[model samples]
Target: MAKTLNPSFSALYSYRIGSYYFHSNNRLFKFLGSRMRMKLIFKMNCDISFLAKIGDRLRLPHPLGVVIGAGVEIGNNVIIFQNVTLGSDGKKGKEKSYPKVGDNVIIYADSIILGNVKIGDNSVVGAKTFVTIDVPPNSLVIGNPCKIIIKN
Candidate 1:
Protein backbone atom coordinates (compact mmCIF):
# COMPACT_ATOMS: atom_id res chain seq x y z
CA MET A 1 0.00 0.00 0.00
CA ALA A 2 2.71 2.38 -0.98
CA LYS A 3 0.88 5.32 -2.54
CA THR A 4 3.13 7.98 -3.86
CA LEU A 5 1.72 11.47 -4.38
CA ASN A 6 1.55 11.66 -8.12
CA PRO A 7 2.00 15.17 -9.45
CA SER A 8 -0.06 14.29 -12.52
CA PHE A 9 -3.10 13.40 -10.43
CA SER A 10 -5.45 16.27 -9.54
CA ALA A 11 -7.55 16.99 -6.41
CA LEU A 12 -10.30 14.63 -7.69
CA TYR A 13 -8.21 11.87 -6.10
CA SER A 14 -9.09 13.23 -2.64
CA TYR A 15 -11.37 10.31 -1.73
CA ARG A 16 -8.54 7.81 -1.92
CA ILE A 17 -6.33 9.97 0.28
CA GLY A 18 -9.21 10.91 2.58
CA SER A 19 -10.21 7.26 3.19
CA TYR A 20 -6.66 6.02 3.48
CA TYR A 21 -5.22 8.59 5.92
CA PHE A 22 -7.71 7.80 8.67
CA HIS A 23 -7.23 4.02 9.14
CA SER A 24 -3.56 3.59 8.33
CA ASN A 25 -0.08 4.92 8.87
CA ASN A 26 1.59 5.29 5.53
CA ARG A 27 3.84 7.69 3.65
CA LEU A 28 0.66 9.56 2.82
CA PHE A 29 0.15 10.56 6.45
CA LYS A 30 3.79 11.60 6.76
CA PHE A 31 3.31 13.74 3.70
CA LEU A 32 -0.19 15.02 4.56
CA GLY A 33 -2.15 14.78 7.81
CA SER A 34 -5.90 14.66 8.38
CA ARG A 35 -6.24 18.44 8.03
CA MET A 36 -4.50 18.52 4.69
CA ARG A 37 -6.44 15.55 3.38
CA MET A 38 -9.72 17.15 4.44
CA LYS A 39 -8.60 20.37 2.78
CA LEU A 40 -8.50 18.55 -0.50
CA ILE A 41 -11.99 17.22 0.11
CA PHE A 42 -13.11 20.77 0.90
CA LYS A 43 -11.78 21.90 -2.42
CA MET A 44 -14.38 19.62 -3.96
CA ASN A 45 -17.04 21.64 -2.06
CA CYS A 46 -17.58 18.93 0.57
CA ASP A 47 -16.51 19.01 4.19
CA ILE A 48 -16.14 15.38 5.20
CA SER A 49 -13.76 15.08 8.10
CA PHE A 50 -11.21 12.31 7.86
CA LEU A 51 -12.12 11.51 11.49
CA ALA A 52 -15.55 10.36 10.33
CA LYS A 53 -16.11 6.62 9.90
CA ILE A 54 -17.03 6.11 6.28
CA GLY A 55 -17.75 2.68 4.85
CA ASP A 56 -17.14 1.36 1.34
CA ARG A 57 -18.84 2.57 -1.83
CA LEU A 58 -19.55 6.01 -0.42
CA ARG A 59 -20.75 8.02 -3.37
CA LEU A 60 -21.22 11.77 -3.23
CA PRO A 61 -22.96 12.54 -6.47
CA HIS A 62 -23.05 16.35 -6.11
CA PRO A 63 -20.54 16.91 -3.35
CA LEU A 64 -21.22 20.63 -2.85
CA GLY A 65 -22.34 21.88 0.58
CA VAL A 66 -22.14 18.35 2.00
CA VAL A 67 -21.04 18.75 5.60
CA ILE A 68 -20.32 15.49 7.37
CA GLY A 69 -19.49 15.71 11.06
CA ALA A 70 -16.49 14.11 12.64
CA GLY A 71 -18.70 11.80 14.69
CA VAL A 72 -20.82 10.58 11.80
CA GLU A 73 -20.67 6.94 10.68
CA ILE A 74 -21.82 6.29 7.13
CA GLY A 75 -22.43 2.71 5.98
CA ASN A 76 -21.73 0.95 2.69
CA ASN A 77 -23.37 1.77 -0.64
CA VAL A 78 -24.52 5.13 0.70
CA ILE A 79 -25.36 7.65 -2.00
CA ILE A 80 -25.46 11.20 -0.63
CA PHE A 81 -26.51 14.09 -2.78
CA GLN A 82 -25.64 17.77 -2.63
CA ASN A 83 -26.31 20.13 0.35
CA VAL A 84 -26.70 17.15 2.70
CA THR A 85 -25.69 17.64 6.31
CA LEU A 86 -24.85 14.62 8.43
CA GLY A 87 -23.92 16.36 11.65
CA SER A 88 -24.66 17.05 15.32
CA ASP A 89 -27.99 18.18 16.74
CA GLY A 90 -26.89 21.70 17.69
CA LYS A 91 -24.99 20.56 20.73
CA LYS A 92 -22.41 23.33 20.52
CA GLY A 93 -18.68 22.63 20.04
CA LYS A 94 -16.47 19.59 20.76
CA GLU A 95 -19.23 17.01 20.88
CA LYS A 96 -19.16 13.48 19.50
CA SER A 97 -22.76 13.58 18.33
CA TYR A 98 -23.96 12.69 14.84
CA PRO A 99 -25.99 10.23 12.80
CA LYS A 100 -25.18 6.60 11.98
CA VAL A 101 -26.58 5.88 8.53
CA GLY A 102 -27.06 2.26 7.48
CA ASP A 103 -26.18 0.40 4.31
CA ASN A 104 -27.92 0.88 0.96
CA VAL A 105 -29.26 4.23 2.07
CA ILE A 106 -30.07 6.89 -0.48
CA ILE A 107 -29.99 10.39 1.02
CA TYR A 108 -31.37 12.91 -1.39
CA ALA A 109 -30.38 16.53 -1.89
CA ASP A 110 -30.43 19.17 0.88
CA SER A 111 -31.44 16.70 3.60
CA ILE A 112 -30.13 17.06 7.14
CA ILE A 113 -29.65 14.03 9.37
CA LEU A 114 -28.63 15.25 12.78
CA GLY A 115 -27.98 13.99 16.32
CA ASN A 116 -27.18 10.38 17.32
CA VAL A 117 -29.99 8.87 15.31
CA LYS A 118 -29.57 5.53 13.56
CA ILE A 119 -31.06 5.33 10.08
CA GLY A 120 -31.91 1.72 9.28
CA ASP A 121 -30.67 -0.29 6.33
CA ASN A 122 -32.22 0.17 2.88
CA SER A 123 -33.72 3.48 3.90
CA VAL A 124 -34.17 6.54 1.72
CA VAL A 125 -34.04 10.04 3.17
CA GLY A 126 -36.00 12.43 1.04
CA ALA A 127 -34.99 15.91 -0.08
CA LYS A 128 -34.72 18.85 2.36
CA THR A 129 -35.84 16.75 5.34
CA PHE A 130 -34.72 17.44 8.88
CA VAL A 131 -34.21 14.14 10.68
CA THR A 132 -33.32 13.92 14.36
CA ILE A 133 -34.76 10.58 15.36
CA ASP A 134 -34.06 6.92 14.64
CA VAL A 135 -35.77 5.53 11.55
CA PRO A 136 -36.93 1.98 11.04
CA PRO A 137 -35.41 -0.34 8.45
CA ASN A 138 -36.44 -0.16 4.80
CA SER A 139 -38.24 3.12 5.28
CA LEU A 140 -38.55 6.45 3.47
CA VAL A 141 -38.19 9.46 5.75
CA ILE A 142 -39.30 12.88 4.55
CA GLY A 143 -40.29 16.43 5.63
CA ASN A 144 -39.04 18.85 8.26
CA PRO A 145 -40.29 16.92 11.28
CA CYS A 146 -39.72 13.68 9.36
CA LYS A 147 -42.66 11.54 8.33
CA ILE A 148 -41.96 7.85 8.24
CA ILE A 149 -43.10 6.31 4.98
CA ILE A 150 -42.51 2.62 5.42
CA LYS A 151 -41.25 0.68 2.43
CA ASN A 152 -41.58 -3.03 1.85
Candidate 2:
Protein backbone atom coordinates (compact mmCIF):
# COMPACT_ATOMS: atom_id res chain seq x y z
CA MET A 1 0.00 0.00 0.00
CA ALA A 2 1.14 3.48 -0.82
CA LYS A 3 2.22 5.54 2.19
CA THR A 4 0.18 8.48 0.93
CA LEU A 5 -2.95 6.35 0.72
CA ASN A 6 -2.90 5.43 4.39
CA PRO A 7 -4.04 8.16 6.76
CA SER A 8 -2.22 6.49 9.64
CA PHE A 9 1.01 6.50 7.69
CA SER A 10 0.50 10.09 6.69
CA ALA A 11 0.03 11.12 10.29
CA LEU A 12 3.17 9.30 11.40
CA TYR A 13 5.24 10.69 8.56
CA SER A 14 4.01 14.18 9.20
CA TYR A 15 4.92 13.77 12.87
CA ARG A 16 8.36 12.39 12.03
CA ILE A 17 9.11 15.19 9.62
CA GLY A 18 7.78 17.87 11.90
CA SER A 19 9.64 16.43 14.88
CA TYR A 20 12.92 16.29 13.01
CA TYR A 21 12.56 19.84 11.80
CA PHE A 22 11.31 21.13 15.10
CA HIS A 23 14.33 19.71 16.89
CA SER A 24 16.76 21.22 14.40
CA ASN A 25 19.02 24.08 15.54
CA ASN A 26 18.25 26.01 12.35
CA ARG A 27 15.54 28.62 12.88
CA LEU A 28 13.97 28.38 9.41
CA PHE A 29 13.44 24.60 9.65
CA LYS A 30 11.96 24.97 13.13
CA PHE A 31 9.49 27.56 11.89
CA LEU A 32 8.44 25.43 8.90
CA GLY A 33 8.10 22.33 11.01
CA SER A 34 6.08 24.16 13.65
CA ARG A 35 3.77 25.35 10.88
CA MET A 36 3.36 21.79 9.61
CA ARG A 37 2.62 20.55 13.14
CA MET A 38 -0.02 23.27 13.58
CA LYS A 39 -1.61 22.25 10.31
CA LEU A 40 -1.65 18.65 11.53
CA ILE A 41 -3.35 19.70 14.76
CA PHE A 42 -6.07 21.62 12.93
CA LYS A 43 -6.61 19.22 10.04
CA MET A 44 -6.04 15.76 11.52
CA ASN A 45 -7.15 16.46 15.06
CA CYS A 46 -4.02 14.75 16.41
CA ASP A 47 -2.42 16.85 19.12
CA ILE A 48 0.86 14.95 19.47
CA SER A 49 3.73 17.27 20.27
CA PHE A 50 7.34 17.11 19.09
CA LEU A 51 8.44 16.90 22.73
CA ALA A 52 6.85 13.46 23.07
CA LYS A 53 9.38 10.63 23.29
CA ILE A 54 7.84 7.91 21.15
CA GLY A 55 9.85 4.85 20.25
CA ASP A 56 10.15 3.06 16.91
CA ARG A 57 7.20 1.47 15.05
CA LEU A 58 4.43 3.28 16.92
CA ARG A 59 1.15 2.47 15.20
CA LEU A 60 -2.02 4.50 15.16
CA PRO A 61 -4.78 2.43 13.61
CA HIS A 62 -7.16 5.39 13.46
CA PRO A 63 -5.31 8.60 14.18
CA LEU A 64 -8.26 10.91 14.77
CA GLY A 65 -8.92 12.46 18.14
CA VAL A 66 -5.68 11.10 19.55
CA VAL A 67 -4.03 13.47 22.00
CA ILE A 68 -0.54 12.58 23.28
CA GLY A 69 0.73 15.14 25.72
CA ALA A 70 4.15 16.76 25.43
CA GLY A 71 5.86 14.72 28.13
CA VAL A 72 4.35 11.31 27.34
CA GLU A 73 6.81 8.51 26.57
CA ILE A 74 5.69 5.64 24.36
CA GLY A 75 7.78 2.53 23.87
CA ASN A 76 8.46 0.53 20.70
CA ASN A 77 5.74 -1.23 18.67
CA VAL A 78 2.93 0.41 20.60
CA ILE A 79 -0.51 0.53 18.98
CA ILE A 80 -2.91 3.33 19.91
CA PHE A 81 -6.40 3.53 18.48
CA GLN A 82 -8.65 6.51 17.88
CA ASN A 83 -9.96 8.88 20.55
CA VAL A 84 -7.22 7.77 22.91
CA THR A 85 -5.77 10.37 25.26
CA LEU A 86 -2.41 10.04 26.96
CA GLY A 87 -2.06 13.10 29.08
CA SER A 88 -1.05 14.54 32.42
CA ASP A 89 -3.14 15.10 35.52
CA GLY A 90 -3.54 18.44 37.32
CA LYS A 91 -0.81 17.56 39.80
CA LYS A 92 2.02 20.06 39.61
CA GLY A 93 5.60 19.39 40.73
CA LYS A 94 9.16 19.09 39.50
CA GLU A 95 8.58 15.52 38.37
CA LYS A 96 7.25 14.53 34.93
CA SER A 97 3.59 13.72 35.35
CA TYR A 98 2.65 12.24 31.98
CA PRO A 99 1.91 8.58 31.36
CA LYS A 100 4.59 6.25 30.02
CA VAL A 101 3.45 3.46 27.69
CA GLY A 102 5.56 0.34 27.45
CA ASP A 103 6.56 -1.76 24.44
CA ASN A 104 4.10 -3.93 22.49
CA VAL A 105 1.16 -2.40 24.32
CA ILE A 106 -2.19 -1.92 22.63
CA ILE A 107 -4.33 0.99 23.80
CA TYR A 108 -7.79 0.58 22.38
CA ALA A 109 -10.17 3.29 21.24
CA ASP A 110 -11.33 6.05 23.58
CA SER A 111 -9.02 5.06 26.42
CA ILE A 112 -7.77 7.83 28.71
CA ILE A 113 -4.41 7.34 30.44
CA LEU A 114 -3.42 10.16 32.68
CA GLY A 115 -0.94 11.24 35.37
CA ASN A 116 2.41 9.70 36.28
CA VAL A 117 1.28 6.17 35.49
CA LYS A 118 3.43 3.55 33.85
CA ILE A 119 1.85 1.02 31.52
CA GLY A 120 3.90 -2.15 31.50
CA ASP A 121 5.12 -4.00 28.40
CA ASN A 122 2.91 -6.35 26.36
CA SER A 123 -0.26 -5.20 28.04
CA VAL A 124 -3.60 -4.35 26.48
CA VAL A 125 -5.80 -1.43 27.51
CA GLY A 126 -9.44 -2.00 26.64
CA ALA A 127 -11.63 0.50 24.85
CA LYS A 128 -13.01 3.44 26.87
CA THR A 129 -10.89 2.51 29.87
CA PHE A 130 -9.60 5.17 32.19
CA VAL A 131 -6.20 4.45 33.71
CA THR A 132 -4.50 6.40 36.49
CA ILE A 133 -2.30 3.73 38.06
CA ASP A 134 0.63 1.54 37.18
CA VAL A 135 -0.18 -1.55 35.13
CA PRO A 136 1.96 -4.63 35.50
CA PRO A 137 3.64 -6.38 32.58
CA ASN A 138 1.67 -8.93 30.59
CA SER A 139 -1.61 -7.65 31.93
CA LEU A 140 -4.99 -6.84 30.47
CA VAL A 141 -6.61 -3.62 31.64
CA ILE A 142 -10.32 -2.87 31.22
CA GLY A 143 -13.11 -0.70 32.66
CA ASN A 144 -13.72 2.95 33.41
CA PRO A 145 -11.79 3.04 36.67
CA CYS A 146 -9.37 0.47 35.24
CA LYS A 147 -9.01 -3.15 36.36
CA ILE A 148 -5.75 -5.00 35.87
CA ILE A 149 -5.80 -8.69 34.98
CA ILE A 150 -2.55 -10.59 35.02
CA LYS A 151 -2.14 -12.61 31.86
CA ASN A 152 -0.53 -16.01 32.12
Candidate 3:
Protein backbone atom coordinates (compact mmCIF):
# COMPACT_ATOMS: atom_id res chain seq x y z
CA MET A 1 0.00 0.00 0.00
CA ALA A 2 1.12 3.59 -0.60
CA LYS A 3 0.56 4.38 3.08
CA THR A 4 3.13 1.77 4.01
CA LEU A 5 5.73 3.40 1.77
CA ASN A 6 4.94 7.03 2.49
CA PRO A 7 7.40 8.54 4.95
CA SER A 8 4.89 11.09 6.24
CA PHE A 9 2.49 8.29 7.10
CA SER A 10 5.04 6.09 8.81
CA ALA A 11 3.66 6.74 12.29
CA LEU A 12 0.11 5.90 11.27
CA TYR A 13 1.23 2.72 9.53
CA SER A 14 3.21 1.62 12.57
CA TYR A 15 0.28 2.32 14.85
CA ARG A 16 -2.15 0.38 12.67
CA ILE A 17 0.15 -2.62 12.34
CA GLY A 18 0.93 -2.60 16.02
CA SER A 19 -2.75 -2.34 16.89
CA TYR A 20 -3.56 -5.31 14.65
CA TYR A 21 -0.82 -7.42 16.12
CA PHE A 22 -1.72 -6.46 19.65
CA HIS A 23 -5.22 -7.75 19.09
CA SER A 24 -3.94 -11.09 17.82
CA ASN A 25 -4.56 -14.29 19.81
CA ASN A 26 -0.88 -15.14 19.73
CA ARG A 27 1.14 -13.97 22.73
CA LEU A 28 4.35 -13.63 20.73
CA PHE A 29 2.59 -11.33 18.32
CA LYS A 30 1.31 -9.27 21.21
CA PHE A 31 4.81 -8.94 22.61
CA LEU A 32 6.20 -7.87 19.28
CA GLY A 33 3.41 -5.39 18.85
CA SER A 34 4.09 -3.93 22.26
CA ARG A 35 7.73 -3.54 21.34
CA MET A 36 6.77 -1.82 18.14
CA ARG A 37 4.49 0.47 20.09
CA MET A 38 7.36 1.31 22.38
CA LYS A 39 9.47 2.12 19.36
CA LEU A 40 6.71 4.36 18.07
CA ILE A 41 6.64 6.13 21.43
CA PHE A 42 10.37 6.61 21.83
CA LYS A 43 11.44 7.13 18.26
CA MET A 44 8.40 8.64 16.63
CA ASN A 45 7.12 10.65 19.62
CA CYS A 46 3.63 9.40 19.02
CA ASP A 47 2.20 7.67 22.10
CA ILE A 48 -0.88 5.92 20.81
CA SER A 49 -1.94 3.19 23.18
CA PHE A 50 -2.72 -0.29 21.92
CA LEU A 51 -5.66 -0.38 24.34
CA ALA A 52 -7.30 2.57 22.61
CA LYS A 53 -10.10 1.66 20.20
CA ILE A 54 -10.01 3.48 16.86
CA GLY A 55 -12.41 3.24 13.96
CA ASP A 56 -11.97 3.34 10.18
CA ARG A 57 -10.40 6.17 8.19
CA LEU A 58 -8.42 7.72 11.02
CA ARG A 59 -6.09 10.37 9.64
CA LEU A 60 -3.09 11.81 11.40
CA PRO A 61 -1.83 14.64 9.23
CA HIS A 62 1.10 15.37 11.51
CA PRO A 63 1.46 12.52 13.96
CA LEU A 64 4.27 13.92 16.03
CA GLY A 65 3.53 14.87 19.66
CA VAL A 66 0.14 13.17 19.56
CA VAL A 67 -0.72 11.34 22.77
CA ILE A 68 -3.79 9.16 22.89
CA GLY A 69 -4.24 7.51 26.25
CA ALA A 70 -5.60 4.10 27.19
CA GLY A 71 -9.41 3.60 27.12
CA VAL A 72 -9.81 6.42 24.58
CA GLU A 73 -12.33 5.51 21.88
CA ILE A 74 -12.39 7.24 18.49
CA GLY A 75 -15.10 6.84 15.89
CA ASN A 76 -14.81 6.67 12.10
CA ASN A 77 -13.45 9.44 9.86
CA VAL A 78 -11.50 11.33 12.48
CA ILE A 79 -8.63 13.66 11.59
CA ILE A 80 -6.14 14.57 14.30
CA PHE A 81 -3.35 17.03 13.80
CA GLN A 82 0.00 17.44 15.56
CA ASN A 83 0.45 17.97 19.32
CA VAL A 84 -3.10 16.93 20.07
CA THR A 85 -3.73 15.01 23.29
CA LEU A 86 -6.75 12.99 24.34
CA GLY A 87 -6.18 11.63 27.78
CA SER A 88 -7.40 11.50 31.37
CA ASP A 89 -7.65 14.28 33.97
CA GLY A 90 -4.63 12.88 35.82
CA LYS A 91 -6.69 11.74 38.75
CA LYS A 92 -5.64 8.86 40.95
CA GLY A 93 -8.43 6.42 41.46
CA LYS A 94 -9.50 2.83 40.87
CA GLU A 95 -11.66 3.81 37.93
CA LYS A 96 -9.67 5.17 35.00
CA SER A 97 -11.27 7.23 32.27
CA TYR A 98 -10.40 8.72 28.87
CA PRO A 99 -12.04 10.82 26.17
CA LYS A 100 -14.43 9.41 23.57
CA VAL A 101 -14.31 11.07 20.14
CA GLY A 102 -17.18 10.63 17.76
CA ASP A 103 -17.28 10.20 13.96
CA ASN A 104 -16.24 12.85 11.43
CA VAL A 105 -14.42 14.86 14.03
CA ILE A 106 -11.49 17.16 13.31
CA ILE A 107 -9.13 17.84 16.19
CA TYR A 108 -6.78 20.64 15.32
CA ALA A 109 -3.18 21.08 16.42
CA ASP A 110 -2.21 21.68 20.08
CA SER A 111 -5.65 20.75 21.34
CA ILE A 112 -6.10 18.85 24.59
CA ILE A 113 -9.12 16.82 25.64
CA LEU A 114 -8.95 15.57 29.17
CA GLY A 115 -11.06 13.44 31.51
CA ASN A 116 -14.04 11.28 30.52
CA VAL A 117 -15.19 13.82 27.98
CA LYS A 118 -17.27 12.90 24.98
CA ILE A 119 -16.69 14.74 21.70
CA GLY A 120 -19.76 14.36 19.58
CA ASP A 121 -19.96 13.51 15.87
CA ASN A 122 -19.35 16.04 13.08
CA SER A 123 -17.58 18.36 15.44
CA VAL A 124 -14.57 20.59 14.89
CA VAL A 125 -12.19 21.27 17.78
CA GLY A 126 -10.14 24.31 16.94
CA ALA A 127 -6.42 24.72 17.46
CA LYS A 128 -5.10 25.21 21.02
CA THR A 129 -8.48 24.32 22.46
CA PHE A 130 -8.76 22.75 25.88
CA VAL A 131 -11.80 20.62 26.44
CA THR A 132 -12.87 19.30 29.82
CA ILE A 133 -16.61 19.07 29.25
CA ASP A 134 -18.72 17.06 26.84
CA VAL A 135 -19.06 18.53 23.33
CA PRO A 136 -22.43 18.31 21.63
CA PRO A 137 -22.89 16.96 18.09
CA ASN A 138 -22.56 19.21 15.02
CA SER A 139 -20.66 21.82 16.92
CA LEU A 140 -17.53 23.92 16.50
CA VAL A 141 -15.45 24.19 19.68
CA ILE A 142 -12.68 26.75 19.98
CA GLY A 143 -10.48 28.77 22.38
CA ASN A 144 -8.61 27.91 25.55
CA PRO A 145 -11.68 28.08 27.76
CA CYS A 146 -13.77 26.50 24.92
CA LYS A 147 -16.71 28.23 23.26
CA ILE A 148 -19.20 26.05 21.37
CA ILE A 149 -20.95 27.03 18.15
CA ILE A 150 -23.74 24.83 16.84
CA LYS A 151 -23.25 24.14 13.15
CA ASN A 152 -26.09 24.72 10.72
RMSD of each: 5.0, 1.2, 1.6
TM-score per candidate, in order? 0.80, 0.95, 0.92
- The best candidate by lDDT is 2
What are the per-residue Cα lDDT tens digits for candidate 3 across 58-86? 89888889999999999999999999999
- Lowest lDDT 10-mer window, candidate 2? 88-97
The list of candidate 2 runs beyond 4 A from truth reads 93-96
In model 3, what are the clashing residue pairs, if there are any? none
- Determine which window of 10 residues in candidate 3 has minimal summed lDDT: 2-11
Candidate 2 C-alpha error for residue 59, in Å: 0.6
lDDT for model 1: 0.80
RMSD of 2: 1.2
* Candidate scoring better on TM-score of 1 and 3: 3
Clashes of each: 0, 0, 0
Estimate the TM-score for candidate 2: 0.95
Please give, for residues 52-110, the per-residue lDDT of candidate 1 as tens digits.
88888887766778888888999999898888999888766756688999999999999
Among these predicted structures, which one has the highest TM-score?
Answer: 2
